[model samples]
Target: MSSFFGAFRRRLLTPPVSETTMEVRGFHVKNAEAKQRLEYIGEVFLKGYAYAVEAGSPAEAEELLETVPRDMRGFAYEGAGMGAAVYDSLPGHGGRLQGLLAGRGRDHDYMIYVGIGWAMARLPKPLWPDIRSTDPLLRWLALDGYGFHQAYFKTAAYVRTPHVQHPFRWRGGHNHYTANAIDQGIGRALWFVGGTDPDVVTDLIRAYPEHRHSDLYAGAGLACAYAGSVGEDELARFVEGAGEHRWALAQGSAFATEARIKAGTVIDHTHLAARVVCGTTAEGAAQVCRDTRPRTPEAAGPFPAYEAWRHDIAAQLASSSLVSKGADQ
Candidate 1:
């Protein structure tokens, strides 16, 4: 009874933040997803890297990573690359390639490295939060246009294109953000099969750069198809191919076009939350193995939950977005 009264009182005191204001406020707040994902990755550094490396090798690691449930594969990739300086094979979210080109000059190494940073930042976190309409103004503020743009800037850097300067120069970067959104929306299922610390890839997918975004998901599907029974090196090659394939797409692609493609790949809320929890757990475990104790009970808790959360969130977002579009039509 007292708790109910307290809740009612708090609701009565809350004020609204206009959508326009939320757009403004969004630009100012540092992206929570970006910060959280990076910290978690930092925690799981060795194990994550080892897993990533194995996934890339023609050995056991690839099989382990590949065997993760289809819905969870994308999320698992995020956990592995959280601490990595370069991150590739993230196609489902958008903004990565575009963000890379815009943030880093056209220099291949610089741009790819920037993309790697973005991949590390975006994969585990959702671009959008699950804010109920009934929530307070502050929460809604996080969903406004300006807020969205600011969040975009978290894992990305802006460039002085002909029509734009920063995130706010247009509607969430305008055509730049939109073009890539399709690729981002679809690439969620793929994995980065190879590359160094941050950047990774797969060669089979690389053969057709023009189809990089659309076809990348095929790699994930392929990985899922043969994950358990495959050898370590074969699995690694497939995973590595995912990254290598993306790198191929990045090169020779126009600056603006690539940015659009990359930008489209940002993850949504469920994956973001799951990765944070998983990453923190992985990092803690690694710390213990390296330092205090060898086997801690708390170490393994984050993995399954991370997988489940990612699967559920991805499914929900996909379905909701589809339904919303149909309703609008």
Candidate 2:
């Protein structure tokens, strides 16, 4: 059943290439072009990963990384995450990528670390056993992930915190924070770190004293829901750990679940993730997400359906909580 769903998901997310363009959310690109771009990015990631696996030291990997085009470095960073994930299956690659990342300064190259964080979040739990350790690079990536979440979501609580300076800018003059890459990276990093222990979420909240507690919790919540390994018991611990910030985490999880549903990446785990974050049954969350999904052509932005789904869920969660409590009482 898992294999079937996996095949189905791949088919849905990666349709056959064609001359005509396809639109998802709002961006439109030729099918072939999109596939080619992703392939190129994937190739870059493999090259970096291979280099890290065989090279004399982390320095060599960094050198090879520099050769990649600056514009594509973010994607390359993401690829490095993939490489790290792949390298995990082999011996001695445990901290190779992390070592390489440690050499890069976070002030200017934060997004690159964000890319790596995103990949780490998405990879399996065993890939990085020391994720919970106070490794400076891991800590920086996790904190930056939270910071990125605050900047991108623009949650009221985080408005006062200074925004991280992103080196890359979108074509439409939007800041790097506005790009989906940042969001993905941050959310995934949370999951990666959170997978180590829900308590890590609390530790991260404390680690970044300047940022809003709510924003940090939200990132952790998204990570818990999307972490893939978190179960009902672990989810409960995360919810408890979040304390006053549970609602923020719920919103983040709901948003992440909705994004997965919108992309037709629904799997058994998707249902579990929705259940954990919303305190609602998986079916209930899926219905809400499906009902709120934006129709094609009507969905005009990079994330119209995603935006709509989150809005609907947020409003519903807000309004229904009182009613649910009343009924329970």
State which candidate has the highest lDDT: 2
lDDT string for model 2 (279-317, tens) is: 675556655656654554134444434344445665676
Give the per-residue lDDT digits (tens) of candidate 1, residues 50-101: 3432233223333443454433333333333321222223233323223322
What TM-score would candidate 2 get against the native? 0.43
- Model 2 is weakest, by summed lDDT over 10 consecutive residues, at 19-28
Q: What TM-score would every model get versus the actual structure?
A: 0.20, 0.43
Clashes of each: 63, 1
- Each model's lDDT comes to 0.27, 0.47
User: Once model 2 is optimally superposed onto the true structure by TM-score, how far is the C-alpha of residue 140 displaced, in angstroms?
Assistant: 22
